[model samples]
Target: MSTSFRMPSIVAALGLAGATLLCTAHAQIKVAMVMPTTGPLTQYGDMVKEGVTTAVEMANAAGGVGGKKIELVAIDDACEPKQGPVAANRVVNAKIGYVIGPVCSGASIAAAPIYNNEGVVVITPSATSPALTDGKNYQFIFRTIGRDDQQGPAAAKFIAEKAKPKKVAVLHDKQSYGQGIASSVRDDLKKAGINVALFEGINAGDSDYSAVITKLKGAGVDFVYYGGYHPEMGLLLRQAGEQGLKVRMMGPEGVGNPEVNAIAGPAVEGMLVTLPADFSANPRNAAVVAAFKDKKRNASGAFQLTSFAATQALLAGLKAVGDNPAKVAEYLHKSTIDTVLGPVSWNKQGDLNSFDFQVFQWHKDGGKSPAAK
Candidate 1:
């Protein structure tokens, strides 16, 4: 669950411990990545790793954030909400100036207050619950990912306009991320006058969803929307297929990972997901994409570009005021930097200057596109 910031190329020079690298950079501002590199959400943690590492390499090669190479220190929180504060404590004790994650919503929530109190700037690439930015007390918490309020409307637009689903059932894992998104979707669907036949919460980490599937079948729902992670969604999709349920399934970015296909088998065919727009597809990002590919990493789907953007924001702010974490955070309140994701700006509440979400469809063996099937 521990990761080092030093890459192999710099390992021998920096004398990194074993395979894990921890090196110093010009700004003397070490940024930690708090994510789940173990447990059930390992795939998600890996995705975050790919993004952060690629961005760090690119920034370092480009003369670092501000004439200083960037260093990434990572710690695994297992995506558990309770582990969040523990991870934050490590980051604070390590004296890192900034942080880029707590990939899951619950974890992010748990860690935000601690980081804010410590005056550490934190930006999450994936956490997207409306509550994360509610009232905006923690000026340090920021998210490039769209909120559930935004994602819910997008999902509703797809269902009501594109799919024309007559009857639908909404399900969630009942976590902060899941329930918030589900509520948004529910509200949007209700506003659109779509019949949300059933609304239920299924226990996460349980392999059995047959009972829920039974309810779905009897509900005569034409579409099912699940607000949760890939594993639970995969199980539901696979079990639904086994039970001969012919309904369409949709979810938010939480289930968009490619690994979902492997877990669900062919049953994941045509699943719908809502996520931030494809940053790599933007012509302006061609250079960043090329840089990432040169380093043997996929710029697409890995939210690393956003992570890169977060790192850049942190570094740019730091240059304005040495390597002071508190001062850097205060400076981050008003700074714009160009990154792989897009031109970035942060509000005081730690929300992105922009709120954008896109609906994507996952094809079991074909393609996952921003557009619905």
Candidate 2:
């Protein structure tokens, strides 16, 4: 009789514990981080992740959104266009309604349709291609960063007015982001009356850019604007230096990664690139900056604050409208949320109202300073 009574009590206790666990699980809101976890571009993903993670951590610490903790689910697309839809599907299948990034433009473009179609709200922090939203009319897809068209012109103006190169070579990686920005720079250069001697595409990931280096030397191009990431740019700089091609090089934000220092060595010292303006320097962001420092993360990187602002926008929507993705997206479309990037609002097409892109001179020690005039 005693044994039977004890067994029933134990069963009841176990049932109560299971119910509590289920309730706890359902109380948390999950946001998927769609970024490269594997591949050469993982550093970009890490930069974005740091920002998103910091925002989520701070929010959760401050009583969370709607009384529930925010959980991050990392889904790697390797920054490859082919893997974009796969990552999108993984997030969709898991029923996560929000996303922080598909960090690269090609992947973001490839994945935008799926996220929009599935009613998943995605805010990319670093994908800058204007082509991603030019004709898509995606209501659920948005960006915390400026478009490549905006960035391209900024780069071109600096090159035309500041660097004042005699003959320019505009090169791209043959990918959507690279080629699109390169075309923008090339066109703006023409309008600015800066001679573009060579407009070409270099196969990305090829170890031997020596062939192109040779062409650049032959073309008598005194300056180069490479619309690609650091890997190729690093190789170009290193190889160009080796081949005695003494032209100065510049690129978009994609080439600003510190890993370029390892690849280009002293050749990277004077490299110029356009990056999102430094927001960590803002006095209002002191606490946020301290938070980043406490965690040993750099708040001043190109994507960090943008990604944080993306999280803030998403969380603002969630806090306003609960977990309904449709309503949250609608709220985001209508509201300007205060974020690390200041008061930011998206236009009808889900791009920011305005973003400041600044030119910086990169150093061999992985530091950057305002570009000299």
Candidate 3:
């Protein structure tokens, strides 16, 4: 009788343990990362992923949010506008209540409506297009980074004051993000009474930018600003160098990729870019920076810390109000959360209340230093 009673008690204990394991599995809070997994812009996605993955892992090690482990699901949009809604639908279908990014501005703008309408809270770390939140009134969407307008002015200020070129030429890829920022820089430069010699659009994937380089040479511009990604910027720089149209070039953070170094070779050196302030240098972020170093990731990349901060804001809200997306969105709109980027709060339109866009001088070895004044 004693043996039989002990057997039943042991079985009951095993059953209870199994039930707890299942409960923990079901209690995980799923946050989807909407970004490019396959594309030329995959590096950008990888940078953001490093940040989100680190934040999630650190949070899980600390007992997770509201006693639930956070699960990150990657949904690829390929940084293409047409694929944005498709990626958003996949996240919605999987019932993920929070998202870390749709990395590029065009993709974010395309995906914003779906995320907002479905009550999913999306915080993009790298999309800087002003049109993403300009008139959308999107409560469920937010940004940890500044808009292109903000970055544009910072670049223009440095160009007008520090670089102080005699004739500036503005070029863009004619895409939404590139053109928008190029226009902003051009207008600001004009207002600052700098000569904007030429404003033109170039084909994005062209191999030869000699024609445009010829234009720059003919226009006698001393400085050029190209508002686009690194590929075109790299090509333009290489072709310009080859064609002997030697003008200093500058761009927004989109062109701040290491791949540009390979494309442009030594021509990439001295390239000026506007990027988010380096948060990895902050004393308050020492632990977080160490966490990144432990995983062999660089926390100083353009979107890494911003993405980490986006994850932090989301998790903080989840801790405060559980896994409800709408409540988290409301909380984010009203509350200031301390993140790796420091204290961050959002405006009614889901843009950050304030952000720092700094100038950096790119080196051929894929490192950046604060721009020399």
Steric collisions counted per model:
2, 0, 0
TM-score of each: 0.92, 0.93, 0.93
Q: Which stretches of candidate 1 lie over 4 Å from their true place?
A: 1-21, 24-27, 65-67
Question: Which segments of model 3 are wrong by more than 4 Å?
Answer: 1-27
Candidates sorted by TM-score, descending order? 2, 3, 1
lDDT of 2 at 221: 95
Write the residue-wise lDDT of candidate 1 on 151-222 in tens digits. Answer: 899999889999989899999999999988998999899999999999999999999999999999999999
**Candidates' C-alpha lDDT:** 0.79, 0.88, 0.88
